[model samples]
Target: MKLNKYTWIFVGLIAAVYLGILIWVRLTNPVYLQKNMYQTWENSYVMHPKSDQSFVNTSKNNDHQNPVALSESQGYGMLITVRAAQKGWANQKDFDRFVNYWLAHRDYVGDQRQTETYLMSWRQYYNRHHQWVNDINSATDGDVYIAMALALAAKQWPKDATYYRSLAKNLSDDILSYEYNPQTGALTVGDWVTRDSKYWQLMRTSDVMPDIFMTLAKLTGDSRWRTVNNTMLDRLVDLSRLHHTGLVPDFAWITRDAAKPVKPNAISTKYDGDYSANACRVPMMLATSNNPKARKVLKKMLRFFSHQQYITAGYSLSGKRLVKYQSASFSAPIFFAVSHHRGEGYDNLFDSQKYIFSKPLTHKNYYDATLTVMAALEGLN
Candidate 1:
């Protein structure tokens, strides 16, 4: 029906109000919860800047104190890589020392529920608190080590296919259970079986994601996994591009109100994003194939990783974006990401050899990523 000038004015007003409400929800609701929750290490205006990450002390060793052990039933994927690398480097003694030291401290007892799902590190060391309050975050945690380990195992030693198959399938199922509403473009995780259940946990991109999940998807021949994982990648790109802090929301604070902007907050922990893992995993995803889009993401990750703070022992200097390097943290993933792009091995798939070299040829958590670079280089020919 045709409307008069006054009628049109009223309709426009109503539309403005509706749009305002939508913006409010996206910025303030659960979707935007993270922005207001944790005190960012980079920005303190949002929350009271506490003693969260006051300074940088790379020499500070966390070895003397035994961290809360995570899990023991699994683990050993990277060790195998080390086992293989043992044939090349004489640093076996040094690496094995860490491996054994970690093994001895595996969180085998006390608060068994607090143990992590995969990886030989995080859980076994003291995490103080647990995961986020998002289902997808929880699910991601639920299958981290299992997912990553399986992919590495399959890629490195194919004979272990059966070994990694069941584990990958199980971990994928767990990770998938948290993908209930993928329409919002988010990856969440958490388990909920009892009153003590932490059903939700949210997080931005980390080393434990993308590459591992994508690898699992390929191994299982399940496009669902790839679809969900890629959706995660898309959001990551958005956050990397949009967030003013050069990072993404660390806390999930999920609600029907996500997909909006964030607000200010109070009890801010070290809840900002980190370029280290994001730079590593995003580009790692590109090494498998030659997708032009994936290559772009890979290149972006390289630029990002090159800017982070890496204290000596392969630890993240701060949970925020990479602004400077004050200490000597042995950041190996940086090398690996560069490796894939430079094509370090016999050939060149991603041109990893152009950047990654022996100067910072770290063998820490980067071992897995390095192997990926090698494969990409070999596949190039």
Candidate 2:
């Protein structure tokens, strides 16, 4: 039967409308986009097989090399595994292997100058002279995430609940005793605190993980953990307001005076207040809180970055772009923050997801790849 011209036109209109709906769904549904990102994360970073039971380098030149499992990487891996397990993508056995690998390889440096716990060393190099160096110092953020992962694993695997709970408790206690400064309610960078030293007073803004602190607070029933979160949130908001741009510097010095309240000033005369590698995580961290102040800071940051063509690798506190390159690590958190804000006029969300999905993981870019995975996970949450 020959169709009339009107019938053909009507059919064409239906097809075009269908196509447009498909495009709209792809652009607007964050869950669908998150699933694609998760697949990219799993394919590029996660490794299989007992012999290779770790997140190995799959980016570029490092595939043949032994996996350099940094403490933060292990912590993030465990957290990712827990999430996957909760979603039925992984199992208890997989979670145990990842957790036990890091637990067994932890270093115990006895000296006061170095980290004084059985925490996993910060990094493990494949090089001959330095197969694995403790770096003598533990990163506060690494420990925070590791502790959070353990707390999560406890809930995920009830059969091993006692063991995981104890581990998480000890780590959390150590972090409080060693890293938390009662004098200023600030979590320091490492175990290098001295009563009268300026260096001991310095804090890495990225090291302040409010979400992990909130988790610890719930786990331990201790209000101190909540206090730490509150203190950090206050500092972050103050810093954002101080610069008048809603951007935070990577590092700041917290000064306590007898006559004045404790205040965080951007460290050093040379400190450019550039939101670079470390400060990029600020929005990601803050978005974990339901507090109005936290959301306000996150919204301001989202607004600052929303205007850019691409989220540059670095930016000054004044909203000036500092680097010519765009990075997944930087963009992922911004994507997360924008999603958290649930604000209007953010049509670039799909473009941001596209940039993140544009590359396959390679060995050489493990840091960025890990962060990309983390950001994608954050968006999924």
TM-score of each: 0.48, 0.79
Tell me which residue pairs clash in candidate 2: 58-362, 59-361, 59-362, 59-363, 60-362, 60-363
lDDT of 2 by residue, 297-348 (tens): 7777777776777778888788788878888778777776666656465647
Compose the digit string of candidate 1's lDDT tens values, residues 1-381.
556888999999999999777655533343232222111211211111122211111112212232122221122222333333423321333223333433333221124545443222233222446421111113234245546545554545556557556656655664454333344334553332222334232433442255556666777786766665556555555544553333344333333333222222311333233334223333333445454445555555445444443322222222343334321112333343454555433123223232222122222222332333333223222
User: Candidate 1 overall Cα lDDT vs. reference?
Assistant: 0.37
Which structure among the candidates has the greatest TM-score? 2
